[model samples]
Target: MGVGVLDQTGATFAEYLPGMRAVIIADENTWAAAGAGVQESLRAAGIDSDEPVVFPGQPVLFADDAMVLRVRDILAATGAAAVSVGSGSINDVVKNASDMVGRPYLSVCTAASVDGYTAEGAAITVRGVKSTVTCRAPIAVVAPIDVMAAAPSRLTATGLGDLFEKIPAGADWLVSDALGIEAVDWDVWDLVQGPLQDAIADPDGLRRGDLEAVEALSEGLQMSGLAIQVHGTSRPASGAGHHFSHQWEMEGYGRDWAIPLSHGFKVGLGTLAMCALYEIVIGIDLSSIDVESRLVAWPTPAQDRARVEALQPAPIIRESAVRASAEKYLPPDAARERLERIRRVWPELRFRLAQQLMPASEVEDILRRVGAIHHPSQIGVSLEQLRTKYFQAQTIRARYTILDTLEEAGVLTDVVDRLFAPGGYWYGRSPEPRWTDAS
Candidate 1:
């Protein structure tokens, strides 16, 4: 995790796969960044290895099911333990392949660009739908802080954007806790949330590639993944923000017409949207809810299924949405009780939610300063498409969140519509591009 720690790669690799051969997986860019040192380290540790698999760098590699199978076949044929040497996409491809072959792999991070470096599952695009395929975390992670802090602007910005996502994730957990749908996991909560603010506090410093700020960003991102690894669910780090990201991933969100978007950029824009939404959510007085009316208008299970069908995405994503929607639907009686809970806890819950979330404007400023994607259009997500996710994203995950809370209160549509209406918050904000590369 420190500077010049590529020297320790051999020790780390040996600790996990002693006497086993190393299978290096990297893209051209990452291989250039750290490949030579990794190969040299493995040999120094007396570990034999297969020739590194350096994929083309022209079109940045994607972690799709086909690529996973390709890498899995490579590893399976040689019977070597894997060593993934790239950021999110490369790591996910190798992680999924290693899991499929019944082996744990070590990760060598080229940049502080993703949480999945230490997360338990891989976010693989399967049949055009993004899914988190169950897999174990890397047995060992070797991140060079010096290398990360000196990496390109967009990469560090992505790390910061990924970490900022924890803010809204915490707020959503509060919603579920208040409604008594899912109890908060205090251990995981503290681990991910405790240092988030300080870590994201220095966007200017990070923009300048300052060592301390980058280190904080790096450590904070890894902790979020560690939470996922320990708790066995993305609940510790995902919320409506991730739902929005997942929606785009399924649709194959792109930087240009053909190039797919990075996970961090998707999450960054999603985090920005959710932060703005939270600003509106915290302002609404939940006590003003007309519970009796909501109970009268509450959807029956059949009606709930109908709504999901109407808003559902295609095939695989549709299947998940249907199953999740069915699992979380509540009867009129249960809806009434939940509405009552909201009315009772509205004040305190709002306070907690407000405390937990950063303002949308503040988050946007940080994003801009750090050179991350600060607007939806940068990722080719139109305001209308962004608007649809507010509803579509809710159906795909049964996990209780503010989205579910707003629905139970019978105001989800109203609140969401209000966000895009003229003169409303998030109505007309267009951010300019900063100094960032296409990659």
Candidate 2:
């Protein structure tokens, strides 16, 4: 399936649609931006198409069950194939809805905002928790450079942030491989790594809305999505940073009475945080840790539940967190066993992790140059929240990340504390700097 990144996106869509009727799925904003033109293109191609299915929303459209049902109903009633004409949310909703109706769909991307456009999974809210629902990849992806470049700079920057996540994401995969959780797939890794590095090497053009930069960013994100498709897992493009983003979304932190930051932006901030943690892990002296003492201090299940309750996440999130905590809450004997394994392989693991992650400072500088938000505070998360939830993020997913390694070693708290201390990555910038000192 060819991903068309051309000026003639409408023409490309016409070629794909052929004689089939298409239902243009888009939100109001997307309809204004590119949906109308896509409809006209179908008309010009002599293909029957119904009036566009314009979702009612302002600023953003969410990929929730209701929206998915609405689109599926429209497609079923009209007996038309779907042609999603928007970015992340619209594309995700259509992807899931089309799968429900067992119909192939095409994606007309309007912004370089996320990798979901071409991925096999839809990032949707299920039962009030942000989750990835398995779905079919679009039959074809059409990203017009002009449309992408015209997107708000924040959207493009968010796209850059999403691609930048691969740095820490790759490192996390290395960690998982070291721990025998999941081995890396070099084929899938190669799909996004080279393009990701080249896309962000110099983001000045992206900031200025240059077409080349827009194409590069759009292509990079699309490739990332394809990477996920090839691997049959999100590991190639998601890791610790993505877990942080999912946690914030589940808790409704950034979305409370405010426009939520894009997924890329949230993950970008998360990427920085994860990188900082990686630095700490690399510098740790394994011989110095008193494994017995740390193991004895490990929190019991009761204590873990109490701490999770104190955070007061949504009921569903709290339930999930409490359940997941069991996996990480190891007894002294179990902890000692894990600690011994970690100690035996600490040097090799440290070297692999260090080799995989870019310096936190370097990642931050690139994001800043591209106008991406690098701090969690930029998206309304407080230091207290970060401190409380950083570890929780690890529990929310069964995946093993650098966070899991730190937690198992009983240094996660120390690492978070130092990350928020003065001269640290998040120092003086979080909503509550005083919390850092107390921790």
Candidate 3:
């Protein structure tokens, strides 16, 4: 929580897990980053512990079912409280594992690479499907400003990318609220939005390892997790933006460990893509959306299920589509009312969304300032590839994102196609990754 807080890892443990035996779980690289210091400090403060478990980092660590089970096994054998000493993957591993054994765990962040530090769910790949699993979040997170500032720049970029996605995520909530699909919790919304701009305001400072900037970024990321914890659903923090990231990971963009994609890298592109999609959305003439025609052409639940089955996406993706489509499918009577609602709310809803969403160009500028991936090709995904994913992504999540709303109104495909066509907002923008950055 401050400079040199790594020296107080023991104090964090005492305050959060008093009188309990501690188990340190980290990957080898993270062990070197902060694990070793935490171990020494805990002992110096008189906390008993078992030998730390350091996972091999040869292939780059990822959060998956196997890693969770390994940590769970360690927890079961030791019967000790856990200390998760890493970012993203490592924290999720310990978080999910600790949940399995009904134990409390705290986080000792080595980098601000993600906001899952105090999140209620763990992003884990179970049986090849990368999805969030419901689990207990870390009890407390100890982020040392100096330690975070010393980590690699790309990891900081990842954290910014993760943090920035919230811009469009907020707009997506507006979409759901307008459609009556979901309601926004304003208190929880402010928890993240209140500090978002200031938290990520210093991309250049962050690049130069400014301690102030680092602390802001760290606190901002933690605030996001706190918001997630308060809401009890990722709906407030996730939307079409995350669906794009999940689509990439589930279909094997993440299967090749040699090149190794960071989650935030993909999410950065997803954020930009969603922003671009929002641009198209704001221009659509919703007044003439032809609601009656859409309802007439709407697929029956059985037919929609058949349509999803026929897309022939990856099995897991297809499975998610089927489940989501069935859950969201509405009979013509209800759907007629929904479409009418959209037409009625379009003007005010669009205005509200405009207030909420950042322009794609500005989002890209912020990402470039922080050295994050802001283009499709950075992770080997092309504009054409992205175009295809927009359609596939809508079906993968039952959650009501703007994509779902557009599909209900029958404009999702046409709008996305226009974005990639010549003269569209994203037609020739950042075709290759470019950054005017500080470091």
Candidate 4:
């Protein structure tokens, strides 16, 4: 129900869920790192704990069906309350599995890696498509500063990437509100924006693994989870950036690369892309927009499906993309109506969006300071790949974002091309030449 940020390990768990038998869930590495200590602490608090369920691998755990069932089976057999002892994947798996068993669980965060720890939904992959499955939040969150600060620096950097996304995520929310799609809840906005700014204010310390900085990052992430819980949606914490990440994950896009990106790492790159796109959106003169001409140029479903398939993503991803496109693609009249609304509110919308987002350069600087991957190249994604297919990410989600805005305005292609042009944010960073034309 609430999070407990603490300096001491193991002891805090007792205070939250005293005298209950628990089954600690962790991966091999986490069990060695903190799971064992957590078990010892539970004993000291007069709580009985079954032997920790340790999954094999140093590879990041995917919150998929197999993993969830495995954890659920253990909890069912043991009949003990669950205690997740790692970050992100572990927490999601345990949270969902605990919900399935109708048992309350506590989380002992091992890293400041993601904002899902205290959220009411678990991001899991079901049959190759990534989705946020509704689940109960942990009854209590036990985040020990020392454990989080000492976590692998990459994990912390990943957390920073996730935190940085709040800027563009909030901007997307503002845009959706302006379009009369989804209203922005200022209370939820207030919950995440301030903490995100505070975390970025001392990026150097966070990079160096300072306890205070790590704790701040952890608290901010926890608050983000709480904001989602309050809104009953991920709107406050996710947006176009997350959609991009989900697409990549569904396709196994970066798995074979030298450096596979984590969920937050991919989102960070998507965040940068969204911020750059927002810059373009702000400068557009809606008065010159010709909605009728654009509608005539819109691709048919077959043509769009061919474009998505050309990218050679997984079959499931391609199917999902086309399906979403069908739902999101607008007719000329609908497009004109949406464009008129945008035009009417351009002044207020521009001001609010600008206020909600940090400049892309500032976000990139913070990512660099925290040693996070800010470019697609770092994760082995070609510029052409992103330019050609990134818009499909928007189609895969019903959630409206800046991508949908551009699509509705019939300028997504032009904006994407500009993002790769000379002097653009991604220019000269790609290993290959830019696309010759917007096409």
Task: Encode model 1's per-residue lDDT on 1-439: one tens digit a residue.
Answer: 8778987898899888888899899999889889999999998998888999999997878778999999999998999999999888899999999999998899999887888888999988887677889988889999988777777777888888787888998899888888787789999998899878878889989878888888788888888899999888989899988888787777665634443456777788778888888889988888889988878788888888888888965776777888998899887777778888899999999999988888888888889888888877666567787889999888888887888888888778889988889866668866344323752
Candidate 1 lDDT: 0.84
Q: Compared with the true structure, what per-residue lDDT tens digits does model 3 show for residues 248-353?
A: 8788685675636777877888899899999989888776778777877989888888877776467778887788878988899998888888889999998998
Which regions of candidate 2 deviate over 4 angstroms?
Answer: 1-19, 56-59, 256-258, 287-313, 327-337, 429-439
C-alpha RMSD of each candidate structure in angstroms:
2.0, 4.4, 2.2, 4.7
lDDT of 2: 0.79
lDDT at residue 179 of model 3 (Cα atoms): 82
Q: Write the per-residue lDDT of candidate 2 for residues 244-274, one digit (tens) a residue.
A: 8888778766554435557888888888888
Worst ten in a row by lDDT for model 3: 430-439
Candidate 1 residue spans exceeding 4 A from truth? 255-259, 313-316, 431-439
Per-residue error for 19 in candidate 3, Å, reads 1.3
lDDT of each: 0.84, 0.79, 0.85, 0.78
* lDDT of each residue in 99-194, candidate 4, tens digit only: 999988989888888999989989787876667788899988888777788887878888888878888888888888988989989888889987
- Models 1 onward score TM values of 0.95, 0.89, 0.95, 0.90
Order of models, best lDDT first = 3, 1, 2, 4
Candidate 3 vs candidate 4, TM-score winner = 3
Off by over 4 Å in 4: 1-19, 57-60, 256-260, 295-313, 430-439
